[model samples]
Target chain A: GDSVTQTEGLVTLTEGLPVMLNCTYQTIYSNPFLFWYVQHLNESPRLLLKSFTDNKRTEHQGFHATLHKSSSSFHLQKSSAQLSDSALYYCAPSMNYGSSGNKLIFGIGTLLSVKP
Target chain B: GGIITQTPKFLIGQEGQKLTLKCQQNFNHDTMYWYRQDSGKGLRLIYYSITENDLQKGDLSEGYDASREKKSSFSLTVTSAQKNEMAVFLCASSRTGGAREQYFGPGTRLTVL
Candidate 1:
């Protein structure tokens, strides 16, 4: 079984401040795909970024994450926070099961709130 | 480019009532999934279908039933709605049963009284 963990439940930041949301995962498979999904207030969740290559930084919008196979972590980071960046972020891991289908195990999610 | 559509943006049901949620995808994807999202609990996989006529129970499949009527459609039924239950049901689809990213629908908000 595979699982994802987000250490922070809620993160409050001021506008223009740096943002970091920790994410780690557990999977038996050596190769796993990690993803960050974002959901705004009253909106459906959408893929922010994803990575399969270890130690490679994947960036989308203003966020970036590097998959670290050694640490089993894919922490989301941004240099500057925007008011619009306030949303719910989910850390999910997808493992290949051949014909069984690749299922995504989502973390409890971290809510990021940016204030002026 | 395609979209996943979930019917009935909102649903209100009484306790112990059986409720059904519908999902349709135009991506022509081979796999469809149903997930339950609760506040602070994230999204939990309820059921998934690799292909038409195929169904797989997920971690939160208990008290729920699923049907893959066709390659483009999948439906989930709640065996018995629980009192005070409030959650969102999301439908997603992927190109194949591999490591591809999933596309999600707008979701159906459910509330049980």
Candidate 2:
């Protein structure tokens, strides 16, 4: 079974500070796609970004992550933190949906708090 | 732009009672899923249906049952509620059961008395 681990339970930063949320994963798939999902207060989780290419950085909406197969990590990062960035972040590894019929394995979310 | 709608937004039931939650998706997706959200536990997959009448057990499917009566609808039942239990149930749909974007519903909050 594939699994994801987000070591940070809470990450706090002042406005304009840098953001880094560590995400690591474990799976047997050779082409594992790692994803970052953000959930705001009372809102459903939405895809922030995803990547399958190892060492290739994927960026979206001011956030970025690089999948490193050697380390089994796809850490999310932002150059500057904003108050609107406060939310719960989850990392997941891809699995065959039809053949495997398995649900996405999520990390114990990391809550990011940005203060002005 | 499709939406996933979950009924009753909130659910409150007695311990040992059977409760069901309904999910409807207009995306016409081939796959639908049920997930349980607990604080600090992130989200755990309960069940998923790749197509109508197809049922698959996920990691956390023990206490839950799922039915996909139609392509556009999926439902989950909590066989027996636990006293003082509280958790949020989320319904999601994907174009396929493959690696892709999953559209989610607002979620149904459950509380057992």
Candidate 3:
């Protein structure tokens, strides 16, 4: 079974500072899709970015993440943090194709606290 | 441009009771999924359907049953609720299968006494 690990349980950053949420995965599947999802308070988790091609940076809503297959990592990054960026972030991995209906295996969420 | 609507934002049930949660999607997606989220934990896959009338068990489908009777709807039932079983159930849909990004609905919080 595939598993995702997000090492940071809580991250506190000052506004205007850089942001990074660590995400790593372990899987036996050759082709893996790495994903980043953001969930605000009382809201559903929404896809922020997904990557299939290794080493390619995927950006969405001022956030960027690159899938590093060699390192088995897909760490989410942002150059600047915003107060509104406070949310719970999840890292997920999925098998390629409809093999398993693209079921995602998620990591324990990381709560981002952006302070003023 | 689409929304996944999950009825009853909160649910309270008794032990050994059967509870059902309904989800509706207007995106006409081909795939729908049910996931359970525990407090401060990751979401666990329960069941997924590729299309109408199709069902597949996921990693956490042991105590749950899912029905996809129509293209736009999917429902999950807890066979027997357990005491202190509190979690949020999320519904999601994707236009195509295989590594596609999923659109999620506001989850339903279930509390069993």
Candidate 4:
């Protein structure tokens, strides 16, 4: 079974400060697709960044994450936290190549709080 | 841009009753998925369809059934609702599956009492 883990359940940061949300995964599949999804209050989770190539960095909307196969982690980081960046973040692992019927295993989710 | 629409933003049902939730996608994607999200929890896949008339059971498929009669629509049915069962059901679609992003619906909140 594939599993994703987010170490922090809740991360609080002040606006203009650095942000980092940790995500790690364990899967037997050689090529696993790692994804970061952000969910605003009462909204569906939206894809923020995703990558499969090991050690390659993926960035979107001022957020960046790199897939590290050796470390089995895909940590999301942002240079400056924004008031609007407050949301729930989830990390997921896609079963090989994201084919039809392939399911994504998601982590519990981290509640990110940024205070202005 | 395409949208995934789910009928009946909220659903209320009695225990042991059967309930159905419908989802429609204008994306024309071949893959549609049903997921359950509990409060403060991650999304769990309930069922998914690859194409018309095709159905696949997901990790949380027990006590649930899904139908894919058309390419743009997928429906989920709860055979028997249990008391105190409350969660949100989300519908999503992805273009033909190979490493594509998924577009999600607003989600339907279900309450069983």
Candidate 5:
């Protein structure tokens, strides 16, 4: 069974400061796709960025993450924190599409609170 | 470019009652999924369908049953509600491929009394 781990349960940063949320994963398959999703208040979770190529950086909406296969990490980072950045972030490890695999596992999620 | 709608944004039921949640997606996707989101715990897959009338069990499918009546509608039924059970159920749709982005609905919040 594949699973994901998000080390930071909560992250607090002041506006204009840097942002980082740690994400790790376990899976039996190689070339797993890692994804970052953001959930704002009263809204559905939306895909922020995703990467399957190891060491390749994926960026969206000012947030970026690189899937490091050697370390099994896909840490999300942003150059500057904004008030709108306050939300719940989830890391997911997914089986490659259309390969007789159909499980999408998500981590416990990290709650980011950007302060002014 | 489409939306997923979950009916009855909130649900409340008594213990032992059978509850059902409905999900509708207009993304023309080939895959649809149901997931449970608990406080502090990440989303867990309950069921998924690759196409119309297809059903696949997920990690948390023991207490639930699913129906993919059509390409646009997927529903989940709880065999029996548990006392004090509270969680959000999310519906998602994605194209048939590896690692594609899944579009999610707002979620249906359920509470068992």
Candidate 6:
């Protein structure tokens, strides 16, 4: 089965510090589409970034992620964490199931807490 | 440019009762999905529909029923609410699912007493 993993359940950091949230995936498919979604307090989850091409860095809203096929990883990173960066992050991979439809399998979300 | 609307932002039901959640998307997307979100558990897919009248069971579909009566609307029903159950149900849609970004609704918070 295809699955996404985010080892850290929670990551707390000070404002202006570097940020890195680990994400790894397991899939039998040759080409996988990976995505990152962020959910702020009392808000719906929204797309942060996504990529299918190997080793290509996809970035949005000051966050970036590189999908590495050889390592099966799509880690989210930011040079400097901000107070607004605190949110729940989910790593998802789009999976195709023939005619049924494509689905995004989400990882156990990592909660990033940034403090002043 | 479109929005996904989920009815009844909060719901309270008794144990053993049946509850239904409604979702509507103005995006006119062909694929819709229902997912359950629990604390520290991530989003678990309950059901998804490729198109109108086309339904597919997901990893966590045992206790739920889904309907895709129209392309822009999808509904989910909990067969039996369990005591002390608390979670958020999210409805999302994609242009066609594969290699597409999903737009999510504001979710319905369910509480079973």
Alpha carbon deviation, residue A73, candidate 6 (Å): 1.0
Q: In model 4, which runs have C-alpha deviations exceeding 4 angstroms?
A: A97-100
Candidate 3, residues A1-116, lDDT tens digits: the string is 67888966889999999998999899988788788999998888988899999989899999999999989999999999999999999998876445446667887889999999
A best-first ranking of the candidates according to their DockQ comes to 6, 1, 3, 5, 2, 4
Q: Model 4: which docking level applies?
A: medium
lDDT of 6 by residue, B1-113 (tens): 99999988999999999999999999989999999998888899999999999999999999999999999899999999999999999999997744778999999999999
Per-model TM values vs. the true structure: 0.97, 0.95, 0.92, 0.93, 0.93, 0.97
Cα lDDT listed for each candidate: 0.92, 0.89, 0.89, 0.89, 0.89, 0.92
Clashes of 5: 2
Clashing pairs in 1: none
Model 1: DockQ score: 0.80
DockQ of each: 0.80, 0.69, 0.73, 0.66, 0.69, 0.84
**Which parts of model 1 have CA positions greater than 4 angstroms off?**
B97-99
Residue A103 of model 5, lDDT score: 56
lDDT of 5 by residue, A26-54 (tens): 88788888889999877779999989899
Q: For candidate 2, write residues B1-113 as lDDT tens digits.
A: 89999987999999999999999999999889999999888898899998899898888999889999999999999999999999999999987534667889999999999
RMSD of 4: 1.8
Candidate 2 lDDT for residue A108: 81
Residue-wise lDDT of candidate 4 within A1-116, one digit each (tens)?
78989956789999999999999899998887888999999999999998989988899999999999998999999999999999999988887434445667876799999998
Best by DockQ: 6
Across B10-101, the per-residue lDDT of candidate 1 in tens digits comes to 99999999999999999999989999999988888999999999998889999999999999999999999999999999999987744578
